[model samples]
Target: MAKVLVIAGDFVEDYELMVPFQALQAMGHEVLAVCPDKSAGDKIKTAIHDFEGDQTYSEKPGHAFTLNASFADVSESQFDALVIPGGRAPEYLRLNPAVIDMVCAFAASAKPIAAICHGAQLLAAAKIIEGKKVSAYPACAPEVKLAGGDYADIAVDDAITDGNLVTAPAWPAHPAWLKQFNELLNK
Candidate 1:
């Protein structure tokens, strides 16, 4: 089983973070959930983003998710794959130099990387998606393109895999995202 590292932060989409973390474990993989400046047992608040009749997704307060590992303890080489969940969190997480470096390391190694929705913001900030076809929330398409990536305008429930990276637009694509990511891990 692969040891996967999930990088997340406060206000991360509720289902995007929780589902993968739990589902990966259920699939027999070892998963570690972490947040910047936080340690094991520490918690981060989540938000539920739902699509309604509005222009954008609606946000509601979600559960407090506990971190299972410390960000400072993360060593890129220690994990086999990386997962980045989408939400308002990525908007700020991209500003952290350490976070950018970490994402770069994962990309440099060609390890399996799964990013969804606003998580592309981090990939854009890291400047590691150049020439790759990446899918993210429609709002993030410009960033993906500006970062030199080919934005995949895929269905909300679909996912696309390019090389070692597997990306999707949102949590609705979880089934396809995880399936593709799991295949990459097994390879």
Candidate 2:
């Protein structure tokens, strides 16, 4: 079974974090969820971002996600793949030096990385998206462009895989995103 590392923080998209974490575990993979400056057993408040016929997504309080591992204890060599969930957390996580470095490490190692929605912010901040094809929430197009990545504004239900990186616009694309990541890990 593949050992996966999930990076998340306060306000991480509810389904984006929980779905993949549980689904992967159900598939016989061992997943360790973590957050910067947080230790094992620590919990981070998550938010539900759902489209409610509005111009944008609506946010609501979600479950408190518990970390099963410490961010500081993670090593690129210890995991088979990485998962980055979206939401308000990425906005600040992308600014964290440790988070940026860890992301860069994963990219440098060419490990399978699955990022959804605003999670692309960390890829952009890590400067690893250059010349890569990526997809993310529409609002992240500018960031992808600025990062030298070719932003594919595909449907929210679809996922795009470029090399070892898998990206999707939002949680709505969970099926595709997780499937692609699963294939990559199995490779």
Candidate 3:
């Protein structure tokens, strides 16, 4: 089974993070869920399905051993692939130097980097999309282009390979990310 590391921060879309993650696990691949910080008690909070509520909810950060391992502690030699889930998580994760290095390691090793929605923000910050062709949330199109990627209107499931990169528009269109990501992972 391929080892895949899922990088998520707070406000990660519940479906976006949970669905693909479980799907990857169901496929018999080894998956690790990593958040920021190395803690035994620190928890990442996620709001219940509403983006505009003052009552954002959160699950107590998972057990430190199971909750998060520092991005700084990660090594490219340890994982086979990377999947970035979207949400406010991207906005914050993009700022972490360790996470940036982790994202860069994926491309540095020529591993597939799959992202959706605001997840593209993290990719954009890592400068991995330069001169690459991919797709993301329409709102993020300008950002993607600024990072050197061509925002594609095409569906993500379609096998459009733009120089070793894969893209999906948003969380709602995840079948495409799933298809394209699985394809890249198995390769």
Looking at model 3, the pairs that clash are: 43-61, 157-176
- Candidate 1 lDDT over 1-187, as tens digits, reads 9999999999999999999999999999999999999999999999999999899999999999999999999989999999999999999999999999999999999999999999999999999999999999999999999999999999999999999989999999999999999999998
Q: What is the TM-score of each candidate against the true structure?
A: 0.99, 0.98, 0.81
C-alpha positional error of residue 137 in candidate 1 after TM-score superposition, expressed in Å: 0.1
lDDT winner between candidates 1 and 3: 1
Which ranking of candidates, highest lDDT first? 1, 2, 3
Better of 1 and 3 by TM-score: 1
Q: Which stretches of candidate 1 lie over 4 Å from their true place?
A: none
Report the Cα lDDT for candidate 1.
Answer: 0.97
Best by TM-score: 1
Q: Choose the strongest candidate by lDDT.
A: 1
Q: What shift in Å separates residue 132 of candidate 2 from its native position after superposition?
A: 1.0
